[model samples]
Target: MTKKGDQRQAEELDPRKQTILKAVVDDYVETAEPVGSESLLQRYPLGVKPATVRNEMATISDMGYLHQPHTSAGRAPTHRGYRYYVDRLAEPMNEDEARQIARRLAKTVESQPEMVTATLRMLSGITRYAAVATTARDQSLKLLKCVVTPLTRGRALMMCAFDNGSVDSHVVDLGSALSAQQMRRLNASIAKLVEGQQAAEVVALKLSLPVVEDRFLQDAIARTLRAAQSSARVATRGELYYEGILKMMEHVEFQRSLESLEQVLGALQDKHRVYDAMEQTPENELSVMVGEENPVPELQNCSMVVARYKAGKREGGVIGVVGPARMRYSETLPLVQQMARSLSGVLAKLIEE
Candidate 1:
């Protein structure tokens, strides 16, 4: 039988390999270039010969963790390499540092739009990579209140307030005029039924309510509820900051990668498509999809990092960043996590207010 110690060791990289891998990844991240054994030794005190490091790099390359560009003199980590580094080699943020980062993000961006824009800017600025922050689709919206006001003999305006403090208004046309008392009764009934339910649930409940004496009023209410339900469908907004676009032109792989990125951005612009992609991802998990692992072929040359942010008990959204496979995971991971947490906190407070 395999010993427990053996199993544990099998799950982890050998110390020498781990150190070399870390050194290589760190060097590539800083320089944004392929790393060689000579440079690795110069940057790290590994007490090893250049030839020995070169052999280890070859082993890593054979394992599909490193790739050599035709034009470059050395090797760069592949997406698989980045995955292993993130899952095992990277250090976790300390409690105090995490809190400080969270606080800084919270103080910097005060609104939803600001939060998204700031996140995209920061991701691009720090990583010198293209960045994206897409809003989550399929968020559940709760009704906080509803108000109905008669605008004409055969028309009325309905205003709905979501628990997230976003208000939607619609105008409904009735077949004929109704008395003020009849309007009051209809308003009271709708407010009571919709104040604590989702748009779909409200529509279902309204349909089951006892039909009033005036069929016209009942029809108007149904139409209004349907309009509200349609309006509540998931909507996505985002900011895509393409940093170092010119810098990418310096690499051959980027020639094809840039074209793919444009198509991906176009897909993101269609809110429904963005929602569909975000919903396919699981909640409360940091998802990383690289190269061909992406469902969208246009993303084949890119890597995406996604996480969800909740606004208190009701509203929520998703935040994500996109970059090349060789992007820096150690820095980007913490930054994204911190941004999501701070965004949730700010949105929760805004909705509460």
Candidate 2:
């Protein structure tokens, strides 16, 4: 079946089915227990007989939206059911609800760097699911200022400052010593060559510079530029917080899926994976992945919600959340989006300062 067909089939539940589905999902989400028709009818007014509800639950289970943990136990919504409910049945966040989330996010973070931590905490606290926030490997770097500092007779230090107020230093060996005045001149010249350029661009610019016949300064400048460029290309990752891990363990599905999640989290430490994921993201949009939709196997059983946020007009990063596939999309989507927006606002202000 086509993707839409799968979604539609899941959501094609009738009113009674929807009512029961919602009840099961809600009760399970709250109590982490299998929900029986009688318990559901008693807990929430469904305006239907228990036998009818039972029959409908049977159909829902047959449709792959609900599952029976045992032969006689009540039904619980499966991942398919959760996906269907999220896509069609769950109530969209209203303006008041969105505003409340915005207010809550605003109160937690005072600076840009703090936003990642605040966002993870907020998501975990609000959703009672494990929340994760990661800054893309590529997002943490930018050109600020590049300067060549002489370390000794034949060694020099290439220092580059990023707009994020981070300074990176790399050592370069010179072929020969030069006077302080000559070194100063070379520093100014190299700064002019690549002060504001991106790390990759700086490397290209260095390679294309006209070859000078003067061997000493030529070698020094070449080595200095190479060091500076290498420093710029270095990826620095911001903190990734995994909140409500205990809550995640509370869910049977999550416990079963923890091995996959651990693999994904372990792979996240590989800068390339995080960078590839970030690069694959379309600009100025929020990306959602629901079970099997994620490219990584470790995330196949989880839903990933990611959004890119700018620190200023030109600088930015990404924030994301990872949780069980049965996550509350209605609530998590808006929460993740709002956190990204709020983080961007705070980051922009910090950049201005």
Which stretches in model 2 have alpha-carbon errors above 4 Å? 1-11, 107-111, 136-247, 250-286
lDDT per prediction? 0.66, 0.69
Across 1-353, the per-residue lDDT of candidate 2 in tens digits comes to: 01211234444777777878888887886666789988998899899898998899898898889999988887777767777766666665677877877777667546655676777777777777666555544543557788777788788877888877778888778778877977886787688777877665665776665466667887788777777776765634444555665665665665566675566556555554555454445667777766666666555666677777776786466666667676767677777777777777766676787
Clashes of each: 0, 0
Query: What is candidate 1's local distance difference test score?
Result: 0.66
Tell me how far the alpha carbon of residue 79 in candidate 1 is from the true structure, in angstroms, after superposition: 1.9
Which stretches of model 1 miss by more than 4 angstroms?
1-12, 94-97, 108-115, 122-124, 134-274
Candidate 2 backbone clash number? 0
Give lDDT for model 2. Answer: 0.69
The candidate scoring highest on lDDT is 2
